[model samples]
Target: MEKVKVDLVVTGYVFNDKKEFLLIYHNKLNKWLPVGGHMEQNETPDEALLREVSEETGLSVEILGKSEIGMGGNVKTNLATPFHVNVHNVGDHDHCSLFYVCKAKGSGEIKLQEEEVGGFKWVKKEDLNQEFIPKDVRNIALKAFETVE
Candidate 1:
């Protein structure tokens, strides 16, 4: 079997007017998480995030800006300085995640890709405290919410 190459991935925290965060169920992890994925060849982080969020959640979002959240993409992939990186073992592989905040264009029923995700939901900030997202990502979401409020 071929090892999955570590690379820089971008994620978007798509929040709606109702203050609900968009969460997707990742089939690989069997857990719920924010919308994001690997950057395609020659794609910038911002560009990659926009595409990933739209593909995963079926919603349009505009990325705010690049904020270093002490996050990392992967160990094998060389990441620039000031990114908060932590190692999370995923079976034989590891995930070093970078996150960003984004604003959705409008609210509507999400069209999920069945192969990649089992489902999606709009989670409120209060509900996130007990939700399945990682602490770091949750912190980012909280900060985004606080700023918008």
Candidate 2:
């Protein structure tokens, strides 16, 4: 059997003044992943990233700067990211992830898309090692957390 391909995914490294990272509980796979989703038609990778972040965390995020647009705009390959593959979650498919260093105005009320994402949390970087996020995602979060200050 052939492995399924996610194709593309967008992620946001949401940071708070306390230097905590925002993670969401994805209902699709029942795993904690970055706040992101599949790219919709005619939407740019950045647009998709921002949309997903808002939909998941209800936080308005800004794209700090430019990043490489991957093939078909399926993935956003940012140089600022710590990973080699543009997509953080690989082994699933050839994907490019758009990573943004964003700040939430405050810990406002979050409106999670219950069907897509069940819950969200602002967790400290150190706490992740003891938590259960994907290895690749945890590494990416750690790198982003270090520079969020």
Candidate 3:
């Protein structure tokens, strides 16, 4: 059997004040996806998602999750638990993605990273069923809405 390469990545479902979630048209994937990207060295999943959200949308986001576990001598910090985790193939490789639910913080504009994304949209529950949206993405997006509700 051939070995498959998998990379760690983070994805965030960023919601605005109006209960709309942000979706960006990924240049490489050529599909609409949540704001996220590959994790950098020594960065936690939450940090990666936060950075990706800011870079993709130019908006500060408050990731929603909690870890009641107490910190110890070896534990520098407790990371927020991801709302969902999945390992999906991306043709040439696979991505072990940690999905975080986040809400937009303060005021900001939706400035997309032109080179990384082709376009972006703020979608509501009704919009998730669009033909262009992948099933997993649609399911996860719906879960995100149910989570905040």
Candidate 4:
């Protein structure tokens, strides 16, 4: 049996009031995907997600959903819950990804990080069905739209 290496990854489905969600064309993966990346050591999934989104798309987003518990005693803060979670293959390895729903907070202009992202688009729910989008991405995107709208 092949050794399966699973990494912790985080992604966000960032939506706007216009009912559009953001998608990035990843340079390495060569696929349309949400803004996210592998979690760094000693970082929480939520922190990693926010950092990744900022680095990849340059959009300031507020993660949707909230924690019921308040921070106290050792716990500095409570993180938002992910709307969806899944394990998917990324060629040589696999990613156990946490998916969060978010909304743009300000101007929402995207400045792509060319080293990681090839391009970006704010797509409508209907756009998910396009042939260029992988089925998993389409399904998750639709779910994000459903959650937001």
CA lDDT, every prediction? Answer: 0.72, 0.70, 0.89, 0.88
Sort by TM-score, best first: what order? 3, 4, 1, 2
Ten contiguous residues minimizing lDDT sum, candidate 1:
75-84
Candidate 4 wrongly placed segments (more than 4 Å): 71-74
Error of 3 at 24 (Å): 0.3
Cα distance off (Å), candidate 2, residue 3 = 11
* lDDT (10s digit) by residue, model 2, range 1-149: 99567676667777776888788888877888777777899877777877888877778765554556554565444533422247434455666666666667655567887878888877887788755777877777776775665
Question: Can you rank all candidates by lDDT, best first?
Answer: 3, 4, 1, 2
Give lDDT tens digits, candidate 1, residues 20-139. 878888998898888888878987666777788878878888665544555567633322221233445567666666666677887666888788999887888888777478787677
- lDDT by residue (tens digit), candidate 4, 1-149: 98899999999999877989988999988888888999999999888988999999888889888798767889878888998999988888999999999998888888999999999888888777888888888888887887777
User: What's the TM-score of each model vs. the native?
Assistant: 0.74, 0.74, 0.94, 0.93
Error of 3 at 38 (Å): 0.5
Clash pairs (backbone) in predicted model 3: none
TM-score for predicted model 3 compared with the true structure: 0.94
Deviation from native of the Cα of residue 58 in model 2, angstroms: 1.9
Residue by residue across 56-132, what tens digits does model 3's lDDT show? Answer: 88899888886888887888877878888999999999999999889999885888889998998888898888988
